[model samples]
Target: MTTSVSIFPIRHHGPGSARSLEHALSQLNPDVVLVEGPSDADPVLPFLTQRGMKPPVALLGYVNDDPARAAFWPFAAFSPEFVAFRWAARASARFMDLPASATLAGERRNDDHDDLHSDPLRVLAEAAGHADFERWWETLVEARGDDFEVFDAINEAMRAVRADAPPPTGREAQREAHMRQTIRAALKDGAVRVAVVCGAWHAPMLDVDAFKAKDDAALLKGLPKVKVTLTWVPWTHGRLSVGSGYGAGVRSPGYYDHLFTTRSAVTERWFARVARLLRAERLEASSASVIEATRLANTLAALRGRALPGLDELNEAALSVFGWDSDLPLRLIERELVVGEALGEVPADVPTVPLAQDLAKLQKFLRLKVQPEQIDLTLDVRTDNDLARSVLFHRLNLLGVPWAKERYAGGRGTFKEAWALAWKPEFSVQLVEASRSGQTVHDAATATATDAARTAGTLAELTTLLESVRYADLSGATPVALAALDARAAGSADVSDLLEALPPLARLARYGDVRGRGSESNTLAGGTFRTLLTRAGVGLPLAGVGLADDAAATLRGKVNGADAAVRLLDDPDALRGWQAALTRLADRDDAHPLLNGDAVRRLRDASVLDGPEVERRLGLALSSSVPLEVTAWLDGFLDDSGAFLIHDAGLLALLDDWMTGLDATVFQETLPLLRRVFSRFGKPERRAIGETLRGGGAAGRGVRRELDEDRAMLAVPVVLRLLGVTT
Candidate 1:
């Protein structure tokens, strides 16, 4: 009943390895071929060879119940397994690795071994006089030969390296044992010959007696099992680099793909492709350049005693022939030709996780096809359709799937949001893991937001999270976040923290109505704002005294936040209370002059002071007695706007009188603030202010409106009552 099984090991992405295996399969014509992958993926093997199916795809194996514990076996056009799969489909081969359930369960059992000190590839690369293993592998193994004999040398090398390395443990040990069992089963099936294609590292261990069949059985016995699914998903050439997190990533998959598919004149064919890529970029890469580069590449290869030119030789030739003294243009060749931007496609019938499948359906329904390239998605969240897209992106972000990132649009565009979206192949893994939270994106986002709110340490972080929840339309999470916000606000005493927390809360209160959700949230926000503003009012003046410029900048942000809160609250009582506090701070001489100026400007903007009253106060503050306050006030109040300078003649005269009286030293000392304030003025405004200062205006117009003390005193009772300061 026993069958003859021929064990052949391969490097995962090596084109030479793929060619050698193809030759071996044709020569031996084995009855069956067995590959190393999740056994569950075997069912979907037919889907891979279906028309329009492409390389640069992966077998996504995960436990259906717990998608977070997953593994990827990616294959490019040049991957040995991909070639083997094609050969096997004709020969009706099967997957011979551990099932996803067992692999994931083994991982959960703490059965993992990772040796930090030793690497077999580094040892071989160093021995080959190459700094990088990929270069060494390509030059020594892939570029020279494409026959079964090459694998024999590779096997012996790996055996020697394995002797010096630590043995596999836990999940790795289980995986190897399961592989052995599958090989045994294949052999017992009575085939004339069986080609067992696996990673070269595992070749020596495949001898049947090394792990007794019963021991293999014992290793897999009683392991916790879960339902698992396998699916084929598209992959990218750029992702072929190790940076994409594939375990056996190729440095240049597109190049290897060329090697795998080309029959003769491989170097010539590669150069032609490079020429095409350069021409596409509007670079000068002609047929003549290709011929010269090919000759140069071959010459370099011959000088180095290589059978064929590798990427390094070809790249060197590209630099010399393309007229590029630097590597900048050469880098373009590397990305477009070497790594490439091509994406693979899979048959639609392949089984996928429910969440992944649902997301695909939703993406289609929403008309947002997943793209391999990055794109900007601008959304007017005020519109229903755009709002849906924005909400989907935010929801995915909530579940730790960052397919899109919110970008600042720079304005008070409360309804406008810009997102940079690039859907990666690996986002499927995140979606699988997130599926545990809930069935739909909306449900999962709500669950994730609630969890974040529950664990959030600060009121600001909680408030920001709540804003994300609202933006994602996870209304279910709002109640949980609001409750957490209340608890956090009660215990927090830092005024800056309260300031940071208020704007998002206030925005939600004001705008939530348009979205049909914020009335209750608004009430909660109003209450939190009242409590925070009351505490901030008592501490604001004290905190601002003697602040450095850096601290003043930080305080300026907090002040702006308070300003936003005032606008959003739209409550007369809260406005009056906050305005009163700002007035008190503005009157204090010891307050940070920046804060004083900001308070005065805020009060002016709020229409709390008449034009003449503001001018009189500026005259008092700009006098020589308060030089430091003048600079601080100028930086804070005059920094952002110059409108008042053009229209308010009283303020202009007060500024003009103060400047005329300043001595040379005082002028020099305040010049920075003077330039800063003037810089904000438009050219026209600056010219007008300049002409007025140079005596262009009518002389002695002394635009002071004399205050009638008796008239002002007549309204004292009304002012005192408004101030809650009755005598």
Candidate 2:
């Protein structure tokens, strides 16, 4: 006779919960223990139950579907599940994962929307308590450190917290089928009493009757499966970190890492690691210093009277002993320890694009986070740049890869993109979370993109797209033009494009000025010079003769806008452009009134024009003048006393010794001008300037003199004269 057995739903990974579970199981001592896992995973049980099978190693169940998906429930040393497994195995218990076969296609489908439908209950409960659920969960479950009963109570509370979660649309059906399958396995094996343990959320859904409607093969048979394989991976403490996402793990991963890795309190070990890391980074800290810091850390914990130093205590200790403030040691430790260079890898099988593609993709399966490294991903979207960008973005959208978007103020076709990538442990953790989306990256990408594009105008869609910017550094997403031309972004459409374009143009302009080669250096990078200048509002031009499509009209517009008093010497050909623009502004075409005075001032400063040309302009200005403010602005440009010192290096050479009467603005502007002036010197003079800059300049005269005398000049300066302090 088949007897009804109780299925106790439990959290996938909880130290305390596992403890309570072990207690319950010991009390029940059933003939068989049914687990909510892949039924096909029986072969791995012995390996998991091996004498040396360490706590924290997980029995990963995956579907080698066309697109593969996996479930990771890592076993911690104090994990209740680990303890219960020990109990069951020692008692010669038969364990079975009665879930539907985790097919690759199904895994892919699940990966497609893994966290997109995150429970609203997490949000609601979080809001109600004015506390973060992840932190709360960590404290009660993971962070209790060897306290399993506390973990069980906390998880039980969380079940109640998430009790009112929205009903699963079809996931329930899929889960129940797996349940019935497990029950069928038990019945076939003729087990009298069976104890099943799974997530509390799945508890209510278990039982044979619940899955009575499930068609074992019909419901799951068509799902594309893949021949995926598995291997052991060293789990890091930081991988369990949680914040602002679906599968939140823990807050202080560094502390938890110590908890799991060491046999005893390893706060001192953490300190040693931190000190060594700091020294490796060229920071000086003695062994005594590290020991003292450890002592302080333990003291801090004792002051508050905890079992040992938690992450907060450690940070406080670091901030006090090794830092002036709370930033130094932590920053050093994070770079050295948190994202360590030890991400475990497992070799993937052959490249197969079956229905279970998500199960394993292209002979590569990153079991955990990659060790921190600089990643260079060059995407080639040459075929149809637009189509390629769409696909890339869609795929990245599914994988949750961060690449940036760009637009051209006005241009078309492919534009280059660049990104710098650094892999963190959290990224590997995210991989597990994102894997629930689809079986294959293609399906996940395509579906995610289609849905996003469908909701193109919605706030949610746009926010999600914008959110990817943070990860842009991770994936080198560099399609410049495609991003700018996004038809869906309305009103402020091409602004992003203009923004992307502005950098290159501005850099080009700056490069020219630095080398004195840009056309903007002549008169300044005019608005017209940059094709993207009009796209974004702020104008920061570097150099080059600012030009537009229509040379004549552009020239005319620039000259007439501010022609009269511009310093043409600043531009080698300032007189010509200024003359043309000045004439236009004076001829009763008052549209670009601002440029009239500036053009004339430039021509005057250059002194290229004879007095007659100046007189003629003066006659017109007096004849039909406009705004007083306009004229005053023009006069102010002409009033600049340092017009002759436009370039700083030349001005500084002459004026550094004569600073008695200098104004603040002129002094402030002197450095750039002097550099420019010195740059413009003739070849022979340039060589002399270079020599002076090297060793003969005033700043290094004493050193040069000593070198001439063949003596080291790095000595205290001798006082040449005695002086008394006078008020």
Name the best candidate (by TM-score): 1
Question: Which residue segments of model 1 deviate by more than 4 Å?
Answer: 39-46, 63-66, 106-126, 129-146, 163-174, 209-230, 245-247, 262-292, 323-326, 380-387, 410-416, 446-494, 505-556, 564-577, 586-727
- On lDDT, the leading prediction is 1
lDDT tens digits, residue span 483-587, model 1: 998888878888778778877777666666345655777677667777777877777777778878789789888878887777777878778888888888888
Report the C-alpha lDDT of model 2 over 308-353, residue by residue, as the tens digit: 6656677777877777654766776664465333333322332222
Q: Provide TM-scores for the models.
A: 0.73, 0.43
What is the alpha-carbon lDDT for the whole of candidate 2?
Answer: 0.45
Q: After superposition, how far is residue 119 of candidate 1 from its true place, in Å?
A: 7.2
**Pairs of residues clashing in candidate 1:** none
For model 1, where is the 10-residue window of minimal lDDT?
Answer: 110-119
Span of ten consecutive residues with least summed lDDT in model 2:
536-545
